[model samples]
Target: MTKNNAKAYWKENLRYLFILLSIWFIVSFGAGILLKDTLNHISIGGFKLGFWFAQQGAIYVFVILIFVYVRLMNKLDKKYGFDN
Candidate 1:
């Protein structure tokens, strides 16, 4: 790719990276810590949402996000002709 195209690709990739990382942080730390009490009022399967998120839900979400990020990166790589 030309320098301009490469620069554009990197800019776009950085945007996506920031968005994904922000979400990861929000779900793992924000919901699990900052908003834990506020979320406790809501419940699923007899477990308080906040507590659940803090203890288990966040971990599950983190795992799923990892796979989702991998899939997204794979697609992005293919689309940008960066895949091996």
Candidate 2:
């Protein structure tokens, strides 16, 4: 890739990475601990929201985020002419 294209590609990649990571962190740390009591007021399938996130919800979200990242990066790669 050309210098400008490479720079653009990396910039977009980092932006996506940062956003996804921020979501993961908030779900795992904030919902699971910092905001646990608040979230616990809500329930899902008879389980407390906070407890679910601490045990399983975060893992589910993380897996979804991985798929999201891959899909987004594929589009980005195509846009930047980096895809095969």
Residue 22 accuracy (lDDT) in model 1: 91
How many steric overlaps does candidate 2 have?
Answer: 0
Candidate 2: worst 10 consecutive residues by lDDT?
27-36
lDDT of 2 by residue, 1-84 (tens): 789999999999999999999999999999998999999999988999999999998999999999999999999999999999
Model 1: pairs clashing at backbone N, Cα or C within 3 Å = none
Model 2: CA > 4 A from native: none
Model 1, span 1-84: residue lDDT tens: 678767877887788789888988888688889998999889899899888988898888889877887898788778778887
The model with the greatest lDDT is 2
- CA deviation > 4 Å runs, candidate 1: none
- How big is the positional error of residue 70 in model 1, measured in Å on the Cα after superposition? 1.3
List lDDT for all candidates, in order. 0.84, 0.95
Model 2: residue 42 alpha-carbon error in angstroms: 1.8
